[model samples]
Target: MTRLIVAAGGGGDAVAAAMLHAALYGDDERAVILTYAWDRLLVDPLPGPRGPHDFTGLEPLTRSVLSVPPQARPIPPADSTLPRLAAELPHTLALLDPHHGAQGITRQLEELVDHLTPRSVDLLDVGGDILAGGDEPTLKSPLADALTLAACAQTNTPVRLLIAGPGLDGEIPPDDLRPLLGPHIHTFTTADTTSIAAVLDWHPSEATAMLTATARGIRGTCEVRDAGLPVSLTDEGPTVHEVDLDNALDRNTLARSVMTTTTLTEAEAYSREICGFSEIDYERDKAARLKQQPPAKPDLASVLFRLDEFQAEARARGVTHTTLRRLSEVLRLGGSRRDELRSLMVSARPEQYVAPLWRIA
Candidate 1:
């Protein structure tokens, strides 16, 4: 059967889906992945799954390829996560164009299912926010996952919803996640460091990083994306819970609304209206500015200070590693600071370093 695995939310969900697949179904040559390009704009600035605007040229295949920027470097850098995944698990990656939302994605999945003709299609969410009831106070970034779910729900595909690392996304707290899980929950894997360390070794993903840290035995409150409040991810690692799509949608009010959404813009608009913040717009604009006016040459002292803070935070929370790209950008490293930052990243994991501040994840 051609099994399609969908990462409900973007960020590092692409890699997170792969890890989840390995844990649940082992190796399956028929497996393909679908994901988006929404990431922490400050942390990663690469454009996600190309929208219509991104299509310099589009050639469809089992795993499609659409042309990107020529250099995609200095101005408007391409997304960091997907290219990194392509380097490792090239064949498995299938990108969703962001220009369209649920209806468009539903159409795409329908075509993809006909092409792949898989017996089963599994939609995966690393964190359980996709199941949110929509009233959850801290829910952010629900649009992407909701749109994916909404699109998939329109199809006749036998979709199995698997959510791991409940509340790991830092949006919905674990307390709030339990009641929504209902009776359909089934646990397939329980990772405790040893079982899944290699998962991140190849596909180092931040989406799964919080889950990984939990599996590896980190505890207490952890910081996730500067939520302004503590995200309670340090508790339980994750139990892969399987539920029927209808059952899951029933539990999530946001998912239900998202299911009704005909397009991405509509879904995003609804979510932005709910969250009461223009966070997505702000992030998009910030990313745009990064391309047009790259930050000025950074100072070493301040850069080191930020690095010191980041390292301390990671160690405090048991995060295994940090990408040079994330670190340099967080530190605002430039000119001489860039080289100095590179030296530090190389020293930490020299065997896995790539140039231009590229780290494993």
Candidate 2:
């Protein structure tokens, strides 16, 4: 029987969903992942999530639902990793278009269920942000996850909410999430990460990278994202916990508000009304600023000096490791120069440790 796995917040959640499928079913080709084309501002540069019109060569899974093929490409001005993910992952990767809002997404999901005839539907969230109470001070992105919750609430199939790597997103604190999480379902083993190892090399997902690192027995304080948010990596970082779908909807005030939204604009308005702000607004502003003044070329000496300064402060706070993505931001390097930065760092400091994460020292 096939299993329908929805990547709740998109981006790295899709990567985590692939890992979850492998861990639970083990080489089963019956897993289908439905995810959004929303990525970080550094990756996509676009303000909102890319829809069907933004891609080429998408195969229709249903009259309303479309599946991303390995050959699919995002139209110019719209960037996405879904096409590459489809090529790398073993299961079919279907696009989750949120432009039409919660009700529209519900219809698409219902159509997909009817077409696939899957035995189970699961919502996989890489970080526990899907459980946000909507007022959490650290919550940065919640609209997409809330939209997914609201859409899944209307689906006929019984949906299971699986939260992996609690607090790894640096949104909700681990202490705050302890009371809300349900029974632990599975703790990812090293073998579980085998399918995503190659994908992580090029994927810019900070949370999923931390999750995979934790599963590989790495434990320490990891600073991730452009914000340099410090997340504590522990044994809990590799485990998946199930939350009741109804309970999740109850906790997510924004999701409840957008349950009947007919357009993406309406849903975003509710997000701002309930959560004080919408992530798309932040992305739009950032993208505009980047367009006004593109990132400057990094001076090797200045970059190394800034890195040392940042490392000193991070170490003082007990931070032992950081992702290359975060390091790129720390060094004032643009997304395009990440590889160049890595090569420079490696050649300059051959003794420095490197993997999915680089040693901060």
Candidate 3:
């Protein structure tokens, strides 16, 4: 079961600070922590993976913070962990000027998709106020809606939304946000304080109740209970938000979050479904390369033979038997390998590949 926790807050409310805490400890337990930013400090570290091995699936997505930290560059595998590190988008769609770029925001949609190509995850925007572009009173604020919707449709994940502080305006009823979310949606909330003193007086249980009620009220078409875990509002604040999310959202949400930014083909999906197959491919490639050794010039014939060998190895490892229709897609492979892998897995039923020739005898 996957769980997705979307925490939203206004600037300096420490929304990511809250969500980051949840992400660090949530992954192995089948939980994902995500946040959206209007503006924030880039150098600040959220409570997340100390290292890659801490959790099975964990990452962060941001829309550019105050200052870019050395570790905050939007490049893989760094970008792989953090999706949507843009500075900002135009307030209104009409305001989108090719030359007048938004500050501290990820300006490119393709960049987000490419970054999240690996994990199967869900999308969560932390602060709705910023996402809605601050009630800028223009029809052009659809960038957030556009980005969120596109993220859901393209990645096949429903986005979890958060409404905080002034964001809960009259024009946009929280309930309306539900229908917009596809079947994969999951939602949560956390404490928001105007000052450190207010933060000190916050009650964990009471805050959690508010989050639970908010989730129920803002419920989307997707069955919240079926797709996610029960809400748990923690007083631990952003430091432990990820842990709280792990306990709240279920496996379905977690799976969605990892895939939210990922684009998969039938082949890659197949590889994921068939346990041990990917490991087999890795080992086979490793062994083949080792056999080739180094310094040896390859003839055309040898190269052709090597290609044939690779194909045969793939078949033996159950790659060729997949139901992926776009066989030519794999042949044209460059960066689309991820999608191809998913397609192959989702395309064919494993039963059809039972023949000995395709199997390792």
Q: Please name the candidate that would achieve the greatest lDDT relative to the true structure.
A: 2
Model 2 alpha-carbon miss at residue 3, Å: 1.6
Report the poorest 10 consecutive residues by lDDT, candidate 1: 66-75
**Ranked by lDDT, top first:** 2, 1, 3
Clashes of each: 5, 0, 55
Candidate 2 residue spans exceeding 4 A from truth: 298-302, 346-354
What local lDDT score does residue 181 receive in model 2, on the 0 to 100 scale? 95
Model 3 per-residue lDDT tens digits across residues 1-361: 3344322221222323233224333324433233333211111112111122222232234231122222343322222212222122101110111111211112333333344442433333332322331233321122322223333333333333333311222223333333332332223332222212222111111122223223323221110111111122122111111111221222122222323322222222333342213222443454354445432232334433543554565555444221111121223222213233323432442443221111111
Best by TM-score: 2
> In candidate 2, what are the lDDT values of residues 114-167, reduced to their tens digit?
988998899999889999989999999999999999999999888999999998
> What is residue 182's positional error in candidate 2, in angstroms?
0.8
Candidate 1 lDDT over 1-361, as tens digits, reads 6568877887367666666666656654536777765555533454334353432233454343231222222224433345545445524566676456576778778878878887678888877888866667776666677778788899867787877877777667777677656344333233433433443443334447667655654444543343323445444445666666887777665556666566556776777666554346666765676678565455555655665677667666655444433554566552224345555655654663422113222
Error of 2 at 286 (Å): 1.1
